[model samples]
Structure formats: C-alpha cells, structure tokens
Target: MLRSGISIISVACLLLFAPIAPSLAAIAPPLNLAHSPITQLSVPMALFSFSGSRPNYLGIEDGKLSPCPGTPNCVSSQSDDAEHGIAPLKYNNSPEQAIAELKQIIGNMKGTEIISDRADYLYVEFTSSLMGFVDDVEFYINPEQNVVEVRSASRLGESDMGVNRKRVEAIRAELNKLEAQEAQA
Candidate 1:
C-alpha cells in the first residue's frame, strides 16, 4: 500500500511539475535558478522514471513494423486494429527527400534523439520534459506504397494518454505543411 501510494504521489508530482519546470526556472530572473529544485529532484525523477529497456524488435520485419503488443500506449501505421492503427505518412517527392524533410521536422522537437538514420529507415527516442518518460518512434520509407510507415510506443506503462497517436498526427501535420511550402518553392 505504501509503495503504491508513493508511486501515485510521484506520478502526480511529475505531471504537475514537468510542464512548468522551464517556467519556474525562468521565474527566478537573470540567474534562472528555477532549475535548482529540478536538480534536487533528480533523485526522485530517476527513482520513478519508468523508462524500460529499448526493445530489440524495433526495425522493419518482413516488410512491416512489429505489431503493437496489444497495448494502448502504442500506435502504428501497420496496425490492423483501429485503436492502434494510423495512416502512413504520404510523400509526393522522392523517398530521400521525404526522409530528409522528416528528419528536419523531428530534429527541432524538444527532447528528441535520433537513434538510427538509414536511407529508408529512421528511429528516434523522445523523452518527456518533466517525468523523463521515453518513447520509441520509428519511420520506414515504403517505396512500394509511396508512404512512410511509422510506429510510436511508450517504453513503459499501458497508457500514454493518446500521446503516441497525437505525436504522429502532429508530425503528419508538420510534414504536410513543409511539403506544401516546398511545392510553393
């Protein structure tokens, strides 16, 4: 009971403070000491951090992304079920250009680290700003379908509050906007 209670409190604190950490730091004026508490809380953050080990089944297998493990914390373009399925990213230009633009879009996002960048495949790790939760996101340029197949999944937990799905959609929106601008140029 005590462990569970602590877990709940930790999650609550993380959720409450994560979004406002930067603001707190800035609130302290020129020195920006808002991050002082963050440093102190690092121990708690590390303790509660549920970042699981990276999955070995990450890359394309047999022409498709690995299926989501019947979990809501994941979304994939190749998923057959609607709950986990998302439309693959479409591209008008060549696959090379498409992936390049994707890298550009993702590179600018907060707390993202590109893990792999091959000619036809890309893998990235995204960390939450406050709680340090990690999510793996992958993209494969499918020339056969003229789309970029994608998979995004949390490293731990069964729910991500639709974050995985929203991220893909957000990236889709950015890609669309970038392509539109490229067309104009």
Candidate 2:
C-alpha cells in the first residue's frame, strides 16, 4: 500500500510538471543574430557586405555592349579574350522581331527584371533564387551584324561558377527554339 501511494504521487508530479517544462524552455530568447547556429546552418546570403557595389557600366558605350571584366564571372560578346568571350545570338529576322522575341524569352525566365528596354538595347537583372544575388545582363541588337550582342555579369561575386555563361547559353537556346518555331509557322 505504501509503495502504491508513492507511485501515484510520482505520476501526479510528472503530469503536473510536463506542461511547464516546455513553457520554461520557451522563456529563453530566440536566436536572431547572423552568426547564430541557425543562420549558419541556413542558406548563405547571395550578396555580402564585402562584395563590391553594383557596376555603373550597364548601358551602351561606344556602340557596344559593356565589355566583360577580367573576372570569369562575366561573359560578353564584345570581349576580345576567349576566356570572357561568348558568341552573340544569331538571328535571321529583323532586329525588332529579335528584340521582341528576346523580351518574351526573358519574361518567361524566373527572377528576371527588365531594367531598361529600348529598340536596340536591353538591360536586365537576374536574381538568384536562394540568396537574391543579382546579375546584370545586357543585349544589343546589331542588325548590321545579324547578331544580338550580349553581356552577362555578376554584381557581387568575383566568380559566379559559370552562372553568367550558363544564363547566356540558356537564353540563346530559348531564342533559337523560338526562331525555329517562327520559321516553321
């Protein structure tokens, strides 16, 4: 009888304290610091304070798209060097039609913001989905050359892990497909 009474008291004490344990834990402050373990474990910010400011060389200069910098994070049709050089998008249609198609393709892409749209020039900002990293992309319709000059560059990092190059290629692929469809139609 004595043991049974003691067991009943222990069970009662546990039931009373169980709900309070979580409340006591909740009294502790939540971690909000950048260096907190939660932040460290989560996805990293795309742009850091140490990353350089956004480039001012976006628009047309000397009848050409902006040249890629020495960094490999950039790729440009106007660049003379092979490391940073990517071929311009070739199209057989009028410059107006090409630009319109380019606009449509860019519109379909995710996280794209068209900053400037002109008859022969276009400036777009592509942001990364994970960390909001921004990449500036420019296109110049060169009807004389029958090619759309392109420049893609990361605004933050020294290297973009070929993101700029891949973006340009993706755009090119889409443009080619669109042009082919138009021809078929």
Candidate 3:
C-alpha cells in the first residue's frame, strides 16, 4: 500500500510538471554569438542594496545621542558598556562652528547623504561602496558636556565587521586634522 501511495504521488507530480516543461524550456532562446563586438551594458556602481529603514530613536533624547542598540553593529559615545562605548568628540569652539566643520568632513565622504543638519544635531547616512549597505551616524553637540556625542549603527545586519567603530575613529581623525589646520591658519 505504501509503495502504491508513493507511486501515485510521483505520477501526480510528473503530470503536473510535464505540460509546463516545454514552456519553461522555451522561455529563453539559445545564446547567439554570431555578432562580434557585442554591445556592452552599464550597471550602477553598487549593484546590491541592503539599506534598512531609518530608525526613529535617532538624535538627542536627554542631552545625548541615542544609546547604541543591543547589537554588535552599533557604537555610541553615550553607551556605557565596553562593547559600545566610544569617547565623545571634544572641540574648543562654538557648537555652530563645530557642526559646520563636521558637515564639511562628512559631506565629502563617498555614498553619504546628510539627512538632517542643525546647529547642534546632525543625522547622516553612510552607504557602503560595494553592497550599498547603509549606516546611520548621528552627532549631537552637547554644550553642557562641551563634546559631540556620536552614534553610528548599521541599519541592517548583526555584524558590521567593526565598520561602525572604524568609521567613528576615521571621523575623529578627520576632525583632529581639520582642527590642526585651523589652529595653524
């Protein structure tokens, strides 16, 4: 009885797929290389996009950038845990001047979009060059702390390969360089 039941299922499957086989096979014609120097096609630089939706918990909540989410793909100066803790940026200038310098530095980065820019708060999106994955980075100049609180989090994925941390460091380096240039000038 079991053998007959199995056979019945097998036959049913074959009958269901048999008529569609020819149509599937005819979906594409055989490749033709008869013409030499075939036309070239252009595709966007970042072919695959994985940018997740923007989070609502961005910007300052209580005189600070949002705490890093419970994931390895995030880093925040406001976070206390070692896994997510990063020092806030210190500047010896007015908050407006600090924000202006930050805007210039971040605007020049590739695949970046400045979503929101204010005197003391900025929300920027940084997209990866290859897979087009986006990371949301925020900076809030807390006059009370006299430092810029930062939060960088990947929109999608559990592991960003330390990208968020490295980006913060790079921005810190850039800020330092810019400060030095201004000091000299």
RMSD of each: 5.0, 16.5, 13.4
- Higher-scoring candidate on lDDT, 2 or 3: 3
State which candidate has the highest lDDT: 1
In TM-score terms, candidate 3 sits at 0.75
TM-scores for every predicted model: 0.78, 0.71, 0.75
lDDT by residue (68-152, candidate 1, tens digit) is 9878999999988999999999999899999999999998898789999999999999988655799999999999989999999
lDDT-best of 1 and 2 = 1
- Candidate 2 stretches with Cα past 4 Å from truth are 1-53
For model 3, name the residue pairs that clash. none
Model 2 agreement with the true structure over 1-185: per-residue lDDT tens digits: 23324365665666677668688679978756867676555544442224345677678877787777777899999898988999999989888988999999999998788989999988998887644788899999888889999999988768898999999999999998997898899
**Candidate with the larger TM-score of 1 and 2:** 1
Worst 10 residues of 1 by lDDT: 39-48
Question: Which order, best to worst by TM-score?
Answer: 1, 3, 2
Q: What are the lDDT figures for the candidates, one per model? A: 0.88, 0.82, 0.85
Candidate 1, residue 100: Cα displacement in angstroms equals 0.6
35-96 in candidate 3: lDDT tens per residue? 74543544454535788788887877668677777889999998999999999988888999
